[model samples]
Target chain A: MQVTKREFLVATAALALASGMRSAQAATAINYWHHFASQSEMAGLMKIIELFGKSHPGIGVTQESIPNSEYMAKVSSAVVAGGRPDTGMVVAERFADLTAMGALVDISERVKGWKGKANFPENRWTGMSQDGAIYAVPAYAFVDWMYYRKDYFEEAGLAGPPKTFDEFLIACRKLTNPAKGRYAFGMRGGAGAFKYVIDVMEAFGSPIVKDGQAAIDKAAAVEAITFYSNLFVKEKVVPPSAPNDSYRQIMEGFRTGQTAMVWHHTGSLIEISAALKAGEQFSTAPMPAGPKAHIARVAYAGNGIMKDDHVDAAWDWISFWGEKDAAIALLEATGYFPASTAALDDERIKSNPIYQAASQTLDFGRLPNRFVGAAGWSESVVNPSFQSVLTGQLTPEQAVDRMIEGLEAALR
Target chain B: MKSVLHRGPLAKLGDLSETRYWVYLLLFPSLILLLLVVAYPTLYGFVISVREMRLTRPGLNGWVGTKHYVAMLSDRVFWISLKNTAIWVTAAIALEVAMGFVAAVALNRNVPGTKLFGVLILLPYFLPNVVAGHMWALLLDPRLGVINDILVKVRILSSYKAWFADPATAMAATIVVEAWHGFPFFALLFLAGLKGIPEDLYKAAAVDGAGPIRQFRLITVPMLRTVITAAVILRVISLVNSPDLLLVLTGGGPGNATQVLSLYAFQTAYREFNFGYAGALAVVMFVILMVFATLYIRLTRVSKD
Candidate 1:
């Protein structure tokens, strides 16, 4: 029954350690929904999740993949049903809307302490912040680029990729040979053309939305639509098929050498490079500039944590993914550019020519407008109106007018 | 007392009451299920239609009675979608019926491989609508498609043209895809009706010195009237409600040139996140379909007699 003080202190310390370990192991699981459905990308995501789970042994992460087109609907339904995933992927522009709804947790303080904060580019962080509060973290940034067949450019006697809008048009015309069943360029023109049109408008120096009003009737936007339409209708540099093509169709056309060039994102370049290595020779260049200097519309896709219940766990999951090492690992595995500056400057990324070329454009990139209720601005108004103008169903002026009316109604 | 139990009116009343009670019990589960699954959502949709609901601004959404309805009435896209739906339904029904009747007659013959041909003709109906849309989109693709290549090689057309991209052709392309997928259903139903027709009637027509065309016009057409009516009504309802195929194939585009009401409502609800406005659009679409269905049923019944 006689006890030494040293032995008693050691026993107390051992008891405290045991309780601490037990509590750490009992942490709740956080649900993470993402739009990455590709096998390789999903595999990379799984690795990140595994790393997070290992580092924070108590925090279990449940990841789900929803198709990109249905992601918004699924997220909305989940939020309305009051069972939103603990963390999920969201577009940067819609962060404002989500924040306004109080559906997203502000991670400003948590992010400030994150070791990777200094590694993220100032612009990337700007996208994640609103009114001095950071709502989410940027995981990756994607921008539009002109993907072309290198062999086709050489065959057409072009020295290199077109440097400006006029040169791009000429290249398209020179490469087009209808008799040979080939087209110079391909553009998506249906309900999905808005992405391309938006890029073009940005390149033309048009603001997508200003003060909750439609600016499509502005001169820059009109010029952008006219320029795109001329490629299809006037010069006929693009095939008639451009109007109906989807992203896949356009990518296929460019990959199969059916078209010389297509307006697409950097993620597409990764896939196209693989196809190129398989005997299809292609390269990418920054999207051609309009009357304004070269400008690219950048979009981000990253994970978001719900504000309601799982705040701490969500923050842990986001911080784990946003770390410099984690981002670099993901970028290397998935062929996507990291949004973090340190990851972007990592020797492995800087040495890659495609990544370097893509990163140069990211410096000049800008996010789309963050109007609260303008989610459908691209699909409902921009695409249809652009289609109408390109197909001669409406004149450029009329198309612009229609788009304004539609945007006004949509924003209302 | 035994005679009363065996022959009196009380026993009949008891039997009738028992039969009624059992019938109600038997129907109860299905009735409850229908109310829960169908009726409840419909009622909820109406309630939602009166609210100003935005998916992104969930907390801000609140009751705004008749506002969504008024907005829909003034919405030009709504009008365009309604017009497109009308075109789709009329064209789909007319073409499917004609094609189905011809196909049913051709396959009704006792020729070699007739049964195999009949089954092959019905195969498209078995395919899911999304797959059928994608399949048609591929087949009709102007750039890398087999159809355009063949057409240009054979000098049928001067050059390749985008079938689904141009406004003039987009609606036609949608109509073709819809009709192709729908004709098989009509063919199967009409064939069943054709087989059920008494062969003796046709033989009597032949003996009356009537030629094949005359017999078809008189006996076959008149006899198949009921089946045709039913097929037309079903096709109309389907064509009006199911533009999901067009949504996939053309996405109601190349400029809203192919937008139907169902696709419009979906875009409004899911894409735009204007659930209240979309719910109002859905309500209007439902009413329109109901009116069309009622008229179709009456027309079919009158023709059948």
Candidate 2:
């Protein structure tokens, strides 16, 4: 049979298109939305993605990084507007809000069947679960700890880091020297200030939420607010900027020697290490004990399915983060503690004295408050209330009353 | 050579253009676009405001007429935000206009380096609000800010000041930063309006024995009235709607000292996940802007002119 050149070209194009479509169909592409904005966090995420690609050749993962502050905004919009990603990063504090909004899919069945689930303890899953249904696979942890300047401590004739709040106050007074333009603590009283405020309240034996209701011990909370605010208002140890010092300000304060100490999580270890020398210049310690009890948060950040359209592929990708290699890779790059029991035993984590504080915290650290309206109550109420105390707009008693009123409203 | 023409859809459209139906055809795309982009979202916002559309508490999703609005009546934050919004908008506008007028007149002088000065003046407007906020935050930082260092060296300050941390100073500091960023918008528009005014008018004023200030009052101000009205309205709308800079610098902090209506609305929607309440707040803002625009135009008599 005779064929025209045009017909031959058309047939060739058809064949190519068919082949491309087949190839595309064979690979299941899943989109992941996360808020890992830091350079090191991105590096760790890329490492995990690279490893996941190698392990699951048939599944393709694409990631979208949202700024941590705007993560919930973006996710909520996605949920309401109907363009949800297949999977997303879920922090302990935001899990309730995310689940309440129905942004995360129920992964309890998948989690139960997975072999890698054995690595995680029941407490690890507690943050990511609601009403006995797991929503995410635990990836890494942000174990709370204190970063203190060793040089400043030694200069002040302090033998070691403070173990209790009373000792911490003494050290704050000793380490602070206004003549040298140095402060004692980098109090994060600005955005995300709610975390420390809640912690302080809990440390003073105030229950934030009990049985999904506001259960704060008013006296304890009042006392907690007074003590925390005193570091800035009364003691004059924290910088004047403490009322507006968030993560960046606090980190800058500690790294530049403007302040003697800061309270942050293990996630900041890599960033701090980049600026200051470990052991000699600065060192890590578990957060100081409060009056009634010690409180440190081991906030487990994990990944959950946002949409179940590509359920199998999404499941595989999130589950991979629970494995030892991914956790270790993340820890190496970002200094985030591993949520998996197996990854905790890695030589890199075990050998580093810098990680000792985080290791100790793993034993006693409490998970962040996880209830509906918890985010709202903390951010809208606790943050501003605490700041009011620091700025002398409201006394500790008034602030506590305000917080109690706000919490009740939130629970209602 | 002879040219050959083909009759097709293009020819058909050309024929259709001559008909009365052509105007409707041209208007059709824009009509659909307006409905989709502007009308639909606005109506939806109104609907949401009257309903219980909390994303987290979906179980409570139902029509709850005037509930959010009623709640706003007694909301302490809402009242504080309202007062702050008035101060933020009014103070920022006054500063922006004064600075912008000075800048516009300076650039209009046609002096040497005016082009470079124009570009320099417009640089702040070119920056995103988020970037500008961060830059200003660092500049006013208590410890390492260059501004603080200079202030101390010049004896303007005994020590560094935490601008955003102090409730007394936070609102004022943010206003100054906003004015710096937004004045360029007025400068550009006013400069354009100045260029269009006849130089003969100024010459006549000068001949009539008007001094520089008198001539400016009589000629420049009168001529730029329309531009001034347009610029004020646009800037007010923009200032009222955006919450980015405040979100970056303060997140409405030091006990909601810097909180404005827009920022409060944003926190209500995103942080609290109370979209219904947010929608009500937005509706209030929308009404406020509408009333302000109407009153402003009436008071200035821009339409009469």
Candidate 3:
């Protein structure tokens, strides 16, 4: 057949268009919304994205980064406004709230059948499940621990990091010297103050919500509050700005040698290492135990399938977080403790003596209170109430009463 | 090369533009836009307020008439926020207007540095509330803050004080920062108003042997009454609606000492996931603003002009 130039050009163009459309149709698009904003966190996320792309050639994933403080607000608004991403990042404490708001899909069957699920411990699964249904897969953990100045301890002739609350207070009194413009502890009574308030309460054997009821041991909570606040108010071991010190203030205080100790998590190791030397200058230790119980939080942060339309792709994206390579990459970049047993064995993590505290905490750490309104009650009520005690505006008893009252209102 | 143009749909639209109802049709687009942007949202909020619409508690979502309002009656935070909002808006407005008036009058004198002064005066208005709040927080930091350093060095303070930590000082400190940021808005408006006042009136007053202060009181005051009223009303609305500055500085702490209505509602809605209660709080704010605007306009008698 004799073909004209016009006909041949038209035929080629049509063929190209048809092939492009077919390729586009075959590509499954999945979107993940998360709240990882730090440079290291973003780098880790990018590495995971690159890894995911290489493994799943048929799927295309897009990630949206929201600020951690505004993540829940954005997620809630998105759920109500109805443009939810295919998958979403969920932390242990937020799992209940996210599931309650219908932002997370039940993936019990998919999670149960996956062979790799065996790599995660029972506690890991427990954090991501509610009402006997799975919502997310564990990715990493923020094992609560303490960062202390080893040099300062040696100067004060202290033995080591305190093993009990009483020892901790004595160490603070001995280390604190106002003339040097240094305090013993950087008490975070500001934005994220809620975590420690709850921790102290738990350490004193006060169950925030017992058997799905608002059951707080008033005496224990008051004791916990009194002990925590006395570190600032009565003992003067914390800085004067303790009532207004959030993450930034406290971290700055610790890094600048204004405070000897700061309570954070394994996540801050990379940032802290940049400012101070490990072992020689600073070190990490397990949080000191209370009279009744030892308390630390092994908060497992993970990803959940928010929409079921692309369930297969969503499953791959979430489950990939548990893979050894992905977990190790995240650990290297952000210093996040891996949730998978396989990744925890990496030599890079095991070689660091500073990580010993986190390892110890893993054996005994409790999960944060997981309930529908846990986030709100902790933040708005508990934080301010505790700060009130720190600032001498309220007594420990008054603060405890306010917390119980606020929790009741929140649950209602 | 010349070609014959076909006037198709364009010609039809031109023809339609010349019709008798064209102006009304043109106005219809703007009316629709107003209904969409303004009316729809306000009405939607009103509807949401009367419903049990807690996002986290979706199972309990249903129509519940005034349940949120009834709860608000006993809400201690709500009452505290209401009282705080009144003090915040009133004190802030009074201070902002005074500063703006003084600045506008000084700049109107056409001094050597008036132009530069005007630009410098307007700088605060350019900063977003979030930035201003954070900047002030750092400046007022108890340990490393320059403000504290200066205060202590000059013996104005016994020692470095934690401004935001004390309930007595928290709101006052936030108000000072807010006033600094907002006075520029009034200055800009008042400066424009100052420009429009006829020089001839001042000259006539001078011929009658009136002093600068007298002419200002007699002529400039009455002439700029409308501008003052408008600026004050707009400012009151802006301050009432904005909770960003307070959010950054205090987050309505050290124990709700700096709590205002807008911040309270925001915490309730986003933090507590209690949209119904937040909506009720918002409705109260809306009602308060509406009544204030109405009474303010009547009292000022700006319509008489």
Candidate 4:
């Protein structure tokens, strides 16, 4: 059964030729990981993938959706264990942590030469960049806004959504009717509740990071806490479950007519639309102004290359998100605001009355606090401290003091 | 006999297999696998607990002996979590054991419809923690909970209650849900043990006029002691280590009222990227579990041959 040298050489050559042909014909597979688990988000992602595939036949994109709650945990573990995807979705709050962990690749040079670069505003790029290196391409924005029952306001003899906090409180009191099991506000005090707490604190003129340092004005924070928690504690205009209501609970409260208003971002518009009428039963409004300022977070969620193996394809996919077709497709499906200002001119977004609040928000909305440990500090410290005040376990001053101490510890 | 034993290949092979070192030779692969799969990761976790290994902040990554421990000692959240974890584990275990024991006894009677009743009792355990947690969360929801509706309709309450939102009832509510999920483990084990018990003993006790309660206390209790100890230990370890139920139901909240050590450790690790502190919390949990297991086995005399 011994083979001759010439015969073996001939067989080897044939195998090599066959392998080379297969390799040449194979499409380049690039994986994209994201935390878009909703039906509409998945639909939007599928549309984007379909468009990308049609446009680039030689490149294959594999999309993986991780649950938002476990997205960072998976990303970090992947980075440590060396199984990172080619690209990953990045939100503004996680940009710093993701980059610091070396899970994101710097693509400043590519971004600099990108043709769609000008479509996004400078602030969007700022949210996507750190240390003079762009880590992600801004894809969509989550413009924070308040959704209220238009009919409820009308029935309460109110003209429209209040423009300031004092009027907002009055409206809350007027709309609340315990006999009907209706509360004024559905306060998000659970998992994703930290965002509104920070917004309110900032509204009271207590900047979390002032001059690149942790400089929370304790007195202002205390005042903010009192004002926010008083809606539950003193005013009694909030649900008893306010201290534990998260995104789902608060949204459910608003949709089911258990509450008059709920504060959330534009990302929830499609979901709310599915449950109630947009222009009649429910309406969106710019967040009410506080004594010092009006705070609305325009959080940009983007895409960044997580590994270097498929940098070109990764860049292609990320940059595609900014294109008008892709942005409009996503906005139509999920109602996520496009980060590209150019795409904002679409007739659907401009002509729709429901998106007026988002348009108003974009005028003055700012990015969320972007710094290392912001996530941990926000969810772990700020959320619970505020909840403690709401539950009457701690006074407003005590909760603010706790937040300050925890913030200092987190920074250190 | 001498001719047969004259260094044949088969004889020598048999002798080689009989040697004491051959046993170790056969065990080498399994021992290596154990070290790789179990021992290495455990040792790594311990080493991480003693360092400042933040995943995001690589510049701060280095050895920091006992720094995490010292920080944890003064951490107010840690203290609150420790207290909550103690109560959560203890109360949940007691409720689960009591319910499981009762359910097992009822099923062991071998009455009509026992099989269907058994299946119904075990249904909750088949659901994953996340599913069960969500189901209970919706059931006890303040805005639209069927439980509250029924209770109010039945005149048990005047109004709806946010079971998981209020500190007064958060832990208790979570414990009830956990007990429902975990009691089946004990019932399954106990049911098996109950079947293994002889009918003769019960007959003799009954003939002697030792009623059902007295017979269960004297015979069944003594017979099931080993199974009871093992089940309680396993359930306690499980309840203390897994915080998914509380995470979903309360997020350890209405102000950390239900914040268990595991949830705190999880938040510290994933949310904060502070693996050092998380590892320390984990090591503390590991030590507590170890001490409990050891003391429990010793006190129960389950190791006696």
Candidate 5:
């Protein structure tokens, strides 16, 4: 059919006007990618999303959960291949790598102007910052603590959790009974074992990185490795599976009464609580101190804008995680400690006796090692080097040498 | 073909199919697709191997002639990984072929429960690599594994054994898991080959007073050589390239005891963000695989047949 020029122009103008009106009325849809795969974590995320929906009805948020192990892989792929989410979860360990790959946008300006920023102190921002520019809004904290079987501790005549590494070793001797399938500690030596390895080194007065270079104290690191590996290799207080036992195995060992104690963070409280009765079956304690120092990591996990396509909506969603209601909701559902001091003051957190260990850790806990190559070095070099020690393939001195060499290579 | 309309805009195109250029025109789409999907990525990978392409340190990315390859010459882990890869591939192939042959021969008899047995034999293959890895991990778990429980009950062991934790047993455990998951691939192919063999040949052998085993060796081996060669090549390529099973079960550790080339390359690329080194690793893998396939085919004399 033939059409006149004036008629076609009129129709095109009408369609454009309709399209403009519809777009003006549409809600800003922003996508969030996170690594919260646990049922409790998902519930907490959904709770915050619900609260967000109520508070900001004009902005719509969609969430995607990636497994923690594969999160960085997927994020890097997205950055290189070009299908980035509006916002993503950022952990302290991944901050440097993420920024180096340009996976996250600089949100320093938005953070400076955020009203809820006051709730987070300087330390909370230290992990998510590089060169005085913040990339994420601190949402919650992963406070390192220990979960011990209370009944077993009582049976072994231990009055309370050990206060130092020496006491911890003595407790290990008393608590272990292999004939009954009981071990003192559930050691994590698999995929994420590097975190504890680094922490132990620091507790023995070995700095990982200082002045933007490899600063590991070889002697102190060797001492730390010897002490830690001895629990499995020489002391035989840990299970035979310590070399390959990761988070799931360790948790199972603690809950099933195979292990008397396991080191983890407060994030796993709800999972353990679901499996065992608090105080009667299990209790929490701060990580025992080493001879040279007491080291416990208080890693602040937060959200950041990955792509600024929907910058305003993404900022709104991430910043809302720092609000009191959002933080409290997450804590109530998942037992993740709130980064916001205002949320930490909530009665639900303060009234719980189980959270006392986490509260104590907050007083003196240090941030994780945050160099550009931290993840690669920890996972690739530190994990294997320590595992070699556990399996008796390398002496403590050799392992320390390997770690020093690897750290130097990484920093270079 | 339609006649050309000289007065319209489509005049030249309407007569195109009538010319010699039509052949090139028909091949043009396929050639474009091949270049886009295959040639481009392959050339890109080769280019990446000779250059620095780290995702984390983008500033340092540039042309670096043979730096990664030179560094790999003295890399202990790379050498260890190469040795382990050889052992892994050889061991897994041996187990898979043995298991698959037995299954295929047993199924060819067509017994009363052959169909059910066939399905059961293929069940492990139906599971994805990730699922099968996790399943085996739980079944062999030191703390609460059913295998450990049974072994203890049967007095086969004094206590539970951590299969994947101990370096001595980690590689063997992963090999067993790989064999279980991959055996069915060979079984299916071999079963089809068995069906295609002439029944008259067996009859003739029986008439000539040859026993079952001798007849089978003489008839079956020669007849299935082509199928066996093809199956082994495909399975080897898959086993060499795919790292998901090992990634899930071991992550190439208990201190590099289970480390293989593919897993090493993957960790280098993703975890370290050192794509240049990973690309170099990939190039090495490609060369090794090409050499293996060529030598294997020649040694077997499958092409002469």
Candidate 6:
């Protein structure tokens, strides 16, 4: 039980060195949170993460999966509790609110030095920037289109998709058969009816909010709402249930041949492709033009790095994911479209017909205005007025007035 | 003789000598848990209700005092939600209680396959609330639903009807779904009460030439008062707080026709991020529930008297 002073000092030194190594190892571990629940998608994401980890041996990546329904709530709570992950994936629209809250680190300077920054389209880059400060990295873009049953379209004497909104209405009228339990369109006329309203308004060149004020009461906005409402109440081309159908139901309507065409996002392409593999015949077309030129509203999901003690780690991960090569890999693995124009030429990506066709429509992609208080715009203005118009509770004019009132109050 | 002379004051207080300390020790854990779980969150929620808290905000939100309360009071949506809650509570409770009593009575009799029937009656209650909402939604679907299919096939109607798409039908559909899910609770409670009632009371009634309905009105209703009152109170509280089924079934749609108070409060807080206003709305709802609970207790006592 007796030891020399020299031996004791040597052992103490060895223990301190081991503890220092352990702390250094722990420091390199970075946390990433995402809301992808699909098995295939998660596997693909983990593969990308593994590849990144392999390329950078100094940093370790940990993935946390959150359900889509509760993703926002969990992220919000995490930020407020000061336990936010280094990198988090969020919908593009939500980035504004988080940036406003100062929860996200402004990566403008870091992104400027990123090799792939110039390759991304201006629109995609603009989506991640607020007041010239880039707060997020653009990942993928989603655009809505009219998906129709090709066989039904032909049977109704339509040689091809309608090129104009009037022609679309005519085709709908011809395709509707109440006796056979089929409708011309499977419209979701409830709170979510705003999706369609947005499509039509954008097509008609009606600004959702113009000059920092809600311009829904404008003539163009009124016309768009009227056209949408007429499909349910006046034209009778849509079923009554359209008023309450969610995105899922609307898709189901198309799958089950309950409607001739459905307005939805390109995300449906995967489902449609799967259905086609199972012998269902369907095709998609760009939304028809209004009195003006056709305009497609694009919604996207992006990844944002939170401003925390781990800022360097956050930038590293963001650069890893947003790099053109990495973005291309993600696009091939998942059905998501790369936000970078350079990735559009990836042979593996271009080989997919859906991606090819979707790329052609990207030129028409438009995003909603960046209102100062945009978070409340959807629930307060879009949903309420959209519901009112669709349900015949208010005329298109009245709905516009109501939306203005609500939006003005919310903005104030 | 010396030992008897030395008995202490603590010993004289029988049972306190060996167990008093143990009683306090045993209760300590539960007391701490209650304070941590219930009291803490309640106080925290109240604190949050007075401030302009936003999840997206960076720092501590400034206090707005009674501003949130005033805004919530003046908000038309809040008032509309209150009216909807009133309608839902009244309709769901009344229908559930009546149907449950009838089902319980029918099960109490010597009917064929009584056990099977009882199990079947309890099935809907056991279903996950969200799944139940989806199931009913499918059944009520205007174009593809089975109920409309059967109704049309059987010559009951000429055309398909949107049961949940119209404002009038949407409210009715929500009430029906809520009632369907709720009745089993009342039925089970009433069945337990029925079993506990002595057979002698029925025998005495029969001897006195009391008719079945008259006996039910006099004996069964009077005897089952406590159980019935408890069931009603529980159901009312549940209906007031839980509006998820309606949210899923109708999405508070057809132009806010079925937007119940709970759903409004949820959207206000979570969706709108107006936590302060939402808290005020919640406080109002809590007060209403307390008032209702008090009235129910008083009414039950008066009926017994």
Winning candidate number (TM-score): 2
TM-score of each: 0.87, 0.96, 0.93, 0.95, 0.95, 0.87
Q: Which stretches of candidate 1 lie over 4 Å from their true place?
A: A1-30, A50-62, A100-103, A130-132, A213-217, A277-280, A307-314, B1-22, B57-60, B110-115, B302-305
lDDT of each: 0.79, 0.94, 0.91, 0.91, 0.93, 0.77
Which candidate number would show the highest lDDT if scored against the true structure?
Answer: 2
What are the clashing pairs of model 5?
Answer: none
B-chain TM-scores per prediction: 0.89, 0.94, 0.93, 0.94, 0.93, 0.90
C-alpha lDDT of residue A289 in model 2: 95
Which digits, one per residue and each the tens of the lDDT, describe model 2 over residues A107-212?
9988989999899999999999999999999999999999999999999999999999999999999999988989999999999899999898988999898987
Over 4 Å off, model 4: A1-27, B1-15
lDDT of 6 by residue, A1-412 (tens): 9989999999999999999998888787778888877755776688778778788878878889986645665766666666888888856666766676666788888888888788776788777888889888887777767787778887988887787899999999999998887888888776456656766876776766777677653688788888878888889998768778777678777777788888777766666666553123777777778876586667666787875666777777777776666776676566677777777678866765545446657777677556545656675567766776777788888887776677786555
Better of 4 and 6 by lDDT: 4
- The segments of candidate 3 whose C-alpha lies over 4 angstroms from its true place after superposition are A1-27, B1-23, B111-114
| Cα lDDT of model 3 by residue, A216-267, tens digit | 9999999999999999888999998888789989998999998999999999
* Candidate 4 chain A worst ten-residue window by lDDT: A21-30
- Number of clashes recorded per candidate: 0, 0, 0, 0, 0, 3
lDDT by residue (tens digit), candidate 3, B1-305: 23235657877788889998889889999999999999998998898899988888888888999999998898888898999999999989888999999999899889899999999999989999999999999999987899999998999997888899888899889989999999988888888999999999999999999999999899988988999999999999998899999999999988888899999999888988988878888999999999999999999999889
DockQ of each: 0.45, 0.80, 0.64, 0.75, 0.81, 0.39
Report the Cα lDDT for residue A334, model 5: 93
Worst 10 residues of 2 chain A by lDDT: A22-31
Q: Proportion of native contacts in model 5?
A: 0.85
The alpha-carbon deviation from the true structure for residue B127 of candidate 1, after best TM-score superposition, in angstroms, is 1.8
Candidate that scores best on DockQ: 5
